[model samples]
Target chain A: MPLVGNLRDFALHDFLYLVDRGYKTGSLMLNRPSTDDAAHLYFDKGKLLSVVRPQRRERLGELLIRLGKVSPQQLAQALQTQQMNNARPLGQILVEHGVIGQRDLQFCIQQQIEETVYELFAWRDGEFKFQAGQKPAPDDVQSLVPLPVENLIMEGVRRVDEMSRIKERIPNNDMIVRFVDRPQEKAANINMTADEWRIFARINGRSSINEIADKIGLTPYAVSHIVFGFITAGLVEVTRPTGGQSSKAPVAAQAQRVGSTPTRRSAAEPAYVEPPKKSLVARLINRIRGL
Target chain B: MQTVKMVISGAVNAGKTEFIRSISEIEVVSTERKATDETRLLKKETTVAMDFGRITIANDLVLHLFGTPGQRRFDFMWEILSEGALGLVVVVDSTRPETFRETTRIVEFFNEMRPAPYIIAANKQDKDTAWSPDELRLALRLPEQVKVVPCIATQRDSCKNVLLELLYEIMETAKEG
Candidate 1:
């Protein structure tokens, strides 16, 4: 089944993160009911391949002509050659015809993709559906190298001023920031800007967002915004620092393990102790199945 | 009698009450009250404290189901509820994207406060707008090992399947240890 929802509930950047992490090959169809307009973005194994809007389905050859990279006659000749070949793409035909350089064509395609995605960031409310295994039209695939969505996610997040959403997770500047377990594996794909990198370096599982901001000389909002990105990327998890807790204690000490024991104990709470034995778990499984 | 507890938690109106009511042998004991906050916009009555339900495995073995309060003001109750639990089932309003962030916060809290085997129940799969389980896994930024089960909490079989999935996860952890 296609993944379907509205942009109001899951924002565009959040969807991009989903696509990137899931390594999904699909076409995301977006529609603005109020404006009666729609946009389509195609991805190949998580990298972006193209963006098309119903109101403005400008062809690559037309885009090249409009940009003065190829004259009308050059595009017409390229189109005629493409018709004869039929198997090759228009951009490839143009490059073979020496009308446009391969580098320039790729640059133009990337620029177009970025522009369309950036424009999509402004959409506040719209319905989005992602159909898996959906491919862009053969002719629509222009970029030799598919655009990785990590940078787009970062840039798109920067454009959003929804501090309210960030505040939902961060809550307060006193909240301590710490890396999630085994972050390096996931962080390999993520590319952080210098501003983000500075914040990333300061996460020691002990420093509060306030302490990190104070140490780096950046405002708390700036630090939190970048930390939000980190959180979104699954590089870290945030928690409120317990009062009177020694800073020297390892965060892992607080990182509770599931089967062996409970990490945080309180006087008011019940022991609720004992990790179930395998025999007991088997009985519970049987009982639930019988139900 | 010996008992094991499994906590069912989610944001407001994610179907916690219905989930418990569907599977519990007894009518779920709940502290539901008329909503006085923004939750009023979603549902007329909200779970303010917690919901309690039970299942009998044998005469001596019973399973306790605790549904954590959905609203943030009642967050203190979560710490109390999550203690030494066998596993956790985090229900997400699959049809409501706005609540996805809130769902993530709940997952983080439980994982931090009392790390245990947990599975996500993508509730409301009966709705056309419900995000697929695969999509919720990504949107929630859950690791690959964590299971995201498709669930319609009103259905008994679906709720039972969610419980079974959590039990299987706990079984794996127990064997590994």
Candidate 2:
């Protein structure tokens, strides 16, 4: 069954995160109501294989020609050869015929796919339906490696209007962020840029996103954007600063009184002591088992 | 009598009432009213306040179950019901991906308020459209330690299994503590 919903209800970055994490193999068909435009994203085992705009119907050979990487005559010959041997992808034929290098073809296709995704991210409303186990056309495989949605999400979130979504987690500029336990394990696949790396290094569980931005001389939006991406990737979490620490002292103090501390606590701080007695838990377990 | 509480929560129409009704030994006390908001589109009646259910552990021990209202306006009730909860069962309508975000919000609320033992009940697992527990885990960004149990809210055995999984989680926490 296909998963269908409008982007208005579920944001694009979120859906992409679902696709990436679910490792879904599907074609996400998106249609813009206002423009009546349609876009197709093909995925294989969670990675984006290709993106196609039905309106354009622009094949790899045409894209290479538009990129000034291949001549019209070269594309024509590749098309003829591709027709003769329908099994081979046009990009592969172009690479084999020396019309375009393999590396260049891959880079070109990746860029095209990235740009299409970035554009789709800008869309605030669209009908999206994901049909599982749907792959791109055999000839459209293009000899290019499938693009990881993680990297795409990192970039796409930056391009799209996603502060509202990020605010759901970060909430406010005063919210402090700390690394999740086993940070290295979670950050393994994350590809952070120079600016993102700068912001990443500033996270000490003591600095707010605003403070990080101030220290790094970047805007709060830039810092929050990166931190939001980190959060989505499960690399970090946001929390209120300790009591009497910030301008929101009263709220922070209340948080302390309520014992709503972040998961990670210092050695000196009191540990969680509210687990019900083991005897009680065991009895409940036994009772439920009998039920 | 000694009383322990476990809060059952989820988005609107995620089947919280159905879950409690299936397992609660007493007639489940639910303050359901005709839907006035957008929830009317999903179901004619919505849990306006909360649902109360119970199980007897022993002659002197009683287990109380509270189901929080599934509307944003009633979020205040969540904190009140979550107080002193032994564990939490976050029910998710596995067939609806749109509600997954709301489900995550509910989990975050409970975690922030009181980091107690909790398990996700992926309800409506019998539906062909339901997302698997593994997929729900990824979609919700739940950690590996948190359990996501398959469930059918309408089934007595299924709801009992969910409660058992939550108790086991609580037992592990109690042992660690």
Candidate 3:
């Protein structure tokens, strides 16, 4: 019988830690019940061979085209070959057609896999099932590599924490931001880093924080960090969309708390203490083995 | 060279893709995949990422249109797709009251982001059971200053008018700025 439980009982990170320690091999399936989106993870000897999130599928050709690695015409040609049902994968079709190099295919695969695992941490409510001794086919395993679940836990937890904080400030992606009057002395000494400067350049009364993040080549969370700093410094004011007329849109300050960036604790502050290891590991193992 | 980005968002099957296709001079690049949830009952596919299209109004002016998935799970993409956009056009299925509620969330969601000027596209106006523009505004609890334009997203003239309205808003904003 498969081990099953709600994520609410055992969080994904703690669950992953147990899997890593036991050196177990099997398939772990997760379903966000409400959304009906599912994730499947195939493992061999405690190493992750592959993970499939069918809903988030990005074909190699499309990934290449989006990254500017291949042209649309080239991708179209590759797709035509893939449509013939020759049992060849789309990535293989692109490689055989010389549309994209072998190296590009490998890189895109890693990018795709990493993105899939990274997004999994956002599952606050879901059902997870682990079936022991179930693995992908041999040929599929040949292309698969054991992923470092621990590293994923470390990064995923960090990202989720930071994203939650950033979102509290940004609310959504469309609210508009404009420069506010700053003390001339402080303005001259804005201590602008390269990313901050890039963001500062885009802070006209029109482009949104999302647009500014894109311009600054940072994630929305990172951009929010910088924007929140500006807000605290009284160097910027955020407002709602004016509908292209003179400023009649509502001000973000007066709007919902989601719109304004609250000043957070300084980095110099103390962090939280970790829970005792033995109890956590023992509890996770019991949960994983379906206690 | 000038490129104006406008976001087209709405509830599931509000016809954001159709709206973009109608006015786009070039082929739209869409990343629609099979719907795996309750949305599958409504349509065979949904846009997991975004839909991209472009129109060239003049040698110096071009408009870029991005369409967002309507489902709430993809709300994360709304922020991603709405970035740098000059304005917004929210499409609503006039026959579906629940869709208006979704539109309300979208309007508030975007408003929270950066209050960009937005207009409601009261789509499917040609349908016999579709609600009137006034009814929709009231049901969605929209303020009076917001414009609600009735449209059939599949029709070229209607889509074009939405684009024109956005452009006019952009021009007026530029004058004010």
Candidate 4:
């Protein structure tokens, strides 16, 4: 029998605990109403076997590179070899070329799974359903160790707390975080993660959070995660953009590529925006057809 | 003065940023980051939020071009940006047939959103492997009213032409409205 209910009635963490305690083998799904996207967790018995989310297809090679397990040049070389012979997965190619060990690839996969599961903690309002007796394919089980639900719940709570802290300081991606002057004594003892330091070195005030992340070769999420820590510690200042020049200046300054003096919008041009309308496209098509 | 806000949307690496940069009078404001997962395999960086760019017309009209992030996870941004926009331009990489379904879904998503008119820019026409406009039209199964214009997003003249085609459609849409 399949169990179905709103997440409001039973929280995701509770549901996960129930499944784990029951020692059941099945797939648990959450339909997040906010994004209209669903998250699927496949389990074999009491242990979590894997996770599937909407539009999430993280490649092993890419995840490895992001985690600093392999260099970009090494990935390129492995890719070239794969193109020539064209027989194996990129992860296999990397291992065969000796760019990364099998153990490292396994670690990245595990981390990917953990991150995917942790992300679901953000979906507060959703419908959850569990269908029993469903199992993942044998191939999907490759090198995957059974993840205990106790660990996931604890980690998920930590991530949720961290995320809310980050969101409080960083409203959206365009908001800029600048390095403020730190007291000399406090600066000496400031603890910073590898990612935090990388983001710290690039904070020039003019660059938005997005630009800083691009320069450091990290995702905005990774950068923001660290910046959030800095914000909580009073080590950095986040400046909310007023939706205009403060946001556009850095781009304009760096855009020497534009080649010539570009004129701004003339005074006569009004920044008028239309009101939102549902089924506007369908209406236009009908009006155009004179139907 | 007249103005239009058109969204430039497509799958990752379909050249949404490049297309905006090709013709915008100023540097484009982008919310791009290093691709973390499978998407990074195709391109090193991906847009997470929205990209802002613009072009000026002779009649004192400013076209505010907002480029929507291509990845499906950022689909919510598409809804937010598409609201109140006069038009949309769906740019698809003609060289990659696999991205067609995503492009179709994005187009349909917008069509369901509002009464706004849109054009499909069949980008990467410079590459020999790219599909021609007619083949692309059939593959996408677009209605006869929607125009499919072949474009090379990196080329200034090509990008300008595609925007011009969209401009015409917007004019017709305004006339009807």
Whole-model lDDT, model 1: 0.76
Candidate 4: pairs in clash: A59-B38, A280-B114, A280-B115, A281-B114, A281-B115
* lDDT: worst 10-residue window of model 4 chain A: A250-259
Chain A TM-score per model, please list them.
0.55, 0.54, 0.60, 0.64
Better of 1 and 4 by lDDT: 1
Candidate 4 chain B: 10-residue stretch with minimal lDDT: B41-50
Candidate 1 residue runs with Cα over 4 Å from true position: A1-274, B36-47, B175-177
- Model 4 regions more than 4 Å off: A65-97, A133-143, A172-174, A181-193, A206-222, A241-291, B1-177
- Alpha-carbon interface RMSD for all candidates, in angstroms: 17.9, 17.8, 27.0, 17.0
lDDT tens digits, residue span A49-155, model 4 = 77766444334444555555666678678868878977666777778888777877777677667767777887778998899977754324223467788898988
Going through the candidates in order, the fraction of native interface contacts each one reproduces equals: 0.26, 0.27, 0.00, 0.01
How would you encode candidate 2's per-residue C-alpha lDDT over B33-69 as one tens digit per residue?
Answer: 4435655524423335456567888876778787877
TM-score of each: 0.41, 0.41, 0.43, 0.44
lDDT of 3 by residue, B52-139 (tens): 5666544544556777767676664566566567678999999988777778988888887646668999999999999999999899
Model 2 clashing residue pairs (backbone): none
* lDDT for each residue of candidate 1 in A27-129, tens digit (9 for 90 to 100): 9999998988799999989999999876666667656654457776777788898888899888988898888888999988887777678668868899999
What does DockQ give for each predicted structure? 0.11, 0.11, 0.01, 0.02
Cα lDDT tens digits for candidate 2, A27-80: 999999797888899988888988877665556655555455777678778889
Better of 2 and 4 by DockQ: 2
